[model samples]
Target: MIPYTLPEVLRLVWSLVWQQIVQHAQVVAWSLFRRHHQAVAQVYHYKRRLALNTS
Candidate 1:
């Protein structure tokens, strides 16, 4: 077994943790963006329907 120094072990652990954090952040951001766009689209459709009904 190769013995890693303390700093090396810490660096490895930190890199793994950072990767997970970045991935989670990306997933969260994408979901929020999709939700916002869906909300906007729904509002647009509702407005269009209202205008059609009023016309």
Candidate 2:
């Protein structure tokens, strides 16, 4: 196995940190998207039910 130099070690650490940050951001974004979609769906469902009840 090749022994890592200081720069190489730093680079590897930076890469891992960046990957983890990107993954976390993606998870947060998806969670928010799902919540927004669910909220919109619920609103639509309620509106439809209200219209049917009034008709």
- Cα deviation of 40, candidate 1, in Å: 0.4
**CA lDDT, every model vs. true structure:** 0.92, 0.92
Off by more than 4 A, model 2? 1-22
Q: TM-scores, in order shown? A: 0.59, 0.59
Clashes of each: 0, 0
lDDT of 2 by residue, 1-55 (tens): 9988999989998888765555888999999999999999999999999999999
Which ten-residue region of model 1 has the weakest summed lDDT?
16-25
Error of 2 at 52 (Å): 0.5
After superposition, candidate 1 runs with Cα above 4 Å error: 1-22
lDDT of 1 by residue, 1-53 (tens): 88999999899988887655558889999999999999999999999999999
**Any residue pairs clashing in model 2, and if so which?**
none
